[model samples]
Target: MKAIVIGAGMGGASAGIALRNFGWQTEIYEAVAQVKPVGAAISIWPNGVKCLNFLGLQRQIKAIGGDMASMAYQDYQSGQILTRFPLRPLVDRVGEFPYPTARAELQSMLLDEFGRGRVFLNKRLIQLEDNGSQVTAGFADGSTATGDLLIGADGTHSMVRRHVLGHDVKRRYAGYVNWNGLVEIDEAIAPANQWTTFVGQGKRVSLMPVAGRRFYYFFDVPLPTGLKQSRDTSRKDLKRYFTGWCAPVQRLIEQLDPMATNRVEIHDIEPFSTLVRGRVALLGDAAHSTTPDIGQGGCAAMEDAVVLSLSLRAHSLGVEDALRRYQESRVERVTSLVLKARKRCDVTHGKDPLATRQWYHSLEHETGEHILNGMAETILGGPL
Candidate 1:
């Protein structure tokens, strides 16, 4: 069987690897001149790590990934710790470690595993035609490629998804903007193994460790969609937004080189009722784009790759049947996550300030065991 995958993000690369593992010839088309990960960092929960294990890349992932020892949620203004939780027990409960990794490094690893020669860069998808038994992909470069199956792993602005779903799906803004960058680790900002976040009044500052003694830091502010910030003004604007946040947050912002920062307005798609159409199917953000509030966006994409491969194998590559089963198996889980993440985003951004306060107050009394168990349940519930 031959499979053509669009977009060379985690989903596309992982889909290629998973399909090839099942003895299918696979090719990936990426619109970029060179495949580079968009974001700064991704927190790979146990569920996502499970996908890597299936692809036999766990060891490589661990090498490039930073393990979190703990997390501290603090009051944004007073800098008081609302809750401190250990992460080790959760790791033991799930039987796999969660990793905070640099997105580019993880992408490079996946591309290597999938075989770089099989990925065609700069091939922006124009259209896809399913001719009963085969699917043909038309590229903007005036090239055409055909395969037994086509997987659209393109992200939020997915062209393949537009073609397969036969409609223009717009990205729904999540009522916020984010500024992120990488900087040398500063234990003064947060412990090396701690994922520290300061939150209040619809804004947050987080500093999380990645590999190589570096930290990926971000500022999230509830703002109107389409708000733009120039580099000269971004630093000053961020400082103004996060005024009186905390000493560490202020210091971190001061250290940022505006040129190196990435600014984005977060958006998610409404969950698709269907993920497959004949010989073509959508994967990752293409199928179900969700807000990154819970850090499950990329993780969901990784799971999609594995689940699609398993479904294909289960149906013995009976194309349409496999695709149908894949959709049936994934829709509920991914949809639930999309809704859950949206809720998290709302709550985190002060949709109900009173409720957020109550939760923070409640966290003071919650035991580490309780917190760990709740998290473990979510991570362990993922596909085996």
Candidate 2:
């Protein structure tokens, strides 16, 4: 059997690797001429790590990922620590520590595992045809590929999704703007082994350790969608929004190169009722895009890869049966996560002002155990 994988991202590459492990031929396609990861860094939680392990990339993941030992929440203005807790317990319970990695490193590792030669670049998918037994994908370059199955790992603006659903999916703006980039690791900004965040006034500044002795940092502020700002003015705009914030935040704004920072108006799609139609299945942001509030966007994609592969391996009825089983198993879980992340986004970004204030107060009295427990619930709920 053969599979046509679209997007060549974390989801597509992993799906290719997984399917190949089960004796299937795979061709991965990418729209861009050169593969560049969309973001600077990503948090691959324990569940995502397990999926990578199943795909035989454990060594590569550990090599490119950061060592995160603890997490802290602090006041945005006063810089007082609201809660500090070790992550060791969560790792112990989940059987693996979350890997905070540079997006480029992770993408490179996945592509290497999937075999660079198997991935075709500059092949934007403009059409998909699922004729029961075989699926064909037509590219803008006037080339076409046919396979027994098609996996749409294309992202939030996925064309494959429209084909499967027979309509376009609307993306919802998350009512915030985000700026993220990398900086040299500095203890004065945040501890080397800690994920530290400062929150207040429906805004957030965070720094988390990634590999290479650097910190992956991001700032989030509640703002209107489609508000225009240039890269040249990102630093000035950040300073204005974060004025009178903590010393670390000020330092971050001052030290960060605005030209290098990526500013985004975050958006996510409503969870779909189905992710499959016949031999075509959707994965990653193509299926259930969600706000970054919970850091599960990529992890969920990894899970989809693993589960889809497993479904294929476990079912003997037929390809369609296996795909249906995969859809049935994932819909509820991904739907719940999409809703949960959206709720968290709303609360954190002041969509519910009272709830946001209550969240800050709750953090003050939190002892880390509750937070770990909640994380454990999400991590353990994986198909692994």
Per residue, candidate 2 scores C-alpha lDDT tens digits across 120-233 of: 999999888988899999999999999999999999999989988999988999999999999999898889999999999999999889999999999999988777797899
Local lDDT at 316 for model 1: 65
The total of clashing pairs for model 2 equals: 0
Each prediction's Cα lDDT score?
A: 0.87, 0.93
Lowest summed lDDT across 10 adjacent residues in model 1 is found at: 373-382
Q: lDDT tens digits, residues 1-384, model 1?
A: 899999899999999999999999999999989877787888898899989999999789999988688988888878888889888888887888888899999999999999999999999888789998999999998999999999999888887777667888888899889888888898778889889988887788998888999998889998887665866677898989988888888889988888888898988888878788899899999899998887888888888899899998987648999899989888888998888889878878877888777667776786677667756766765786
lDDT of 2 at 277: 92
Question: Which run of 10 residues does model 2 get worst, by summed lDDT?
Answer: 223-232
Give the TM-scores of the predictions, in the order they appear: 0.97, 0.99
